[model samples]
Structure formats: C-alpha cells, structure tokens
Target: MPKMIFVNLPVRDLAASTTLYLALGGTLNPQFSGEQSSSIMFSDAIGVMLLTHAHYGVFTKRPIGDARRDSQVLLALSVDSRDAVDATLARAVAAGGRADPNPAQDHGFMFSRSVEDPDGYVWEIMWMDPAAIAGTPETA
Candidate 1:
C-alpha cells in the first residue's frame, strides 16, 4: 500500500473548517469523522483531520496555539497546473479563507499562492512545471 499522510489540526469550528476543506476539493471521509472531528481527504494518500479544541487536547497536554496569532507549520498542496493553483485559492477565499497571506511566488517554472484558513492555518497552493522537476528544459 502507498504511504499516506494525515495532518491533524485543531479548529475552533468543526463545521466551518470542514466546509472550507470541501470547497478546496476535499471529500469527507465519514469512516474517520465524528462530532469532535472531521476527516477530509484530498486524495487517497493525503488527508486532514480537523479536531475540536477539546478533542485535540486529548492527544497533548500543551496549550493549543492560536494559529491566527502564531506560526506553527505551513501546509502546502501541489496542483496539476498554474490555473488549478489559482482556482484553489479562489475557492478558499469564497469559503471564508484569507487570500494571499504571504506574497505570491512566481518563477518561470513554478508558481505559488497562499491562503489562510478561518482558523489562521496557512496553506500554500503551488504548481511546478514537470520539466523543471525532472531537471530538463522545456521545449517549445
């Protein structure tokens, strides 16, 4: 089986966070969801577990950091094309996320933009030319 990643996040509003992730093209995985948490699957291998503050605390004794006020980690999602990156950012904004929390990055072979979720978690949407990734020049 392929390896998978499940990013666990503490959210203030479970419903709102779930909605935002769905808008960004994730599907709800009810098998792993409950009143205290929602499992959003971006792909078969990538998932996000949105947990309520109280539930999240069950796993850690440390205080929950206010994502809106402090930096923890920057999550990144790579899309198929530059247009897809823009589309994802647009969806995030429409779903109540703040767009471009950081400056947009554009290199000839890559492009990226960021969106801050309602809880202040930042997700970087990016696209990179396949040729660049493969260390080859693009032939036009």
Candidate 2:
C-alpha cells in the first residue's frame, strides 16, 4: 500500500473535537485514539490526529497558536461532487462548527466551501470537474 497522510491538530477539548470529526463522516480509529487524542479516518489514505493541547505540547516547544485568532494551516479535502461539498459543510455546521466567514466559491469547473471545526481549524471542502482539469493547457 502507498503511504498515508496524517494531519495532527491540537484542540482544547478532545471529546468535542472527536464528536465534530465523527459528524463529518470520519471513523474513529481506536488503535491510536485515547482520552487525550483521537485518530479520525477520513479514508483509507487520510487520517486526522486530534490531540489535546497538553498532549500536543509534548511534540513541540513553541506555544500552540490560537487558530481562532490566527491561521497556521488550511486543511483541504476533495470530494466527489458539488452536492457533496454542500452536504459536508451543512453537516459541519450542524455538528457545532461554524461556516467560513468568506462567501461560497464557484470557479466554473470547481465549487468549494469552508468550515471551522470546534477547535477553529479551517477545512476546505471542494469538488472539481475531472474533464476541466484534464483539458487545461500545459505549460513548459
């Protein structure tokens, strides 16, 4: 199998963050999850490690930046269709997350929406037309 990707994010509350991820359609991988952290499986190749601030501090010397005040990273995930993108955002809002302050994006062949999880991490949910991507002119 190819290598998988794991996004480690620090959160204030592990249980609340875990609930938000579960509502986003992610499965909890108990093997790597515990009271201080949660391993959320978005797919076979993608996983998110939600760690409590204290637990997360063990891995870094710098202070944990407050995502609500500043942005460190924007985690984006590609979905199957425009409807799926909308559905995911809707689910996010219903699960105690907030919608993006920016307006919805519609770029002809692509559609996107953003949401902030309970911990203020931004997640970009997007869908793009395969044909449109394939038809793009190549540059040297």
lDDT of each: 0.93, 0.88
Candidate 1 local lDDT, 1-140, one digit each (tens): 99999999999999999989988889999999999999999999999999999999999999999889999998999899999999999998998889999999999799999999989999999999998888755553
How do the predictions measure up, each by TM-score? 0.94, 0.91
lDDT of 2 by residue, 1-140 (tens): 88999999999988888888887779999999998899999999999999988999999989999998898887888888999998988888888889875567899899998989887888888999987867756621
Specify the highest-TM-score model's number: 1
lDDT for model 1 comes to 0.93
Model 2's TM-score against the true structure: 0.91
RMSD (Cα, Å) for all candidates, in order, is 2.4, 2.4
- Model 1 lDDT-worst window of ten: 131-140
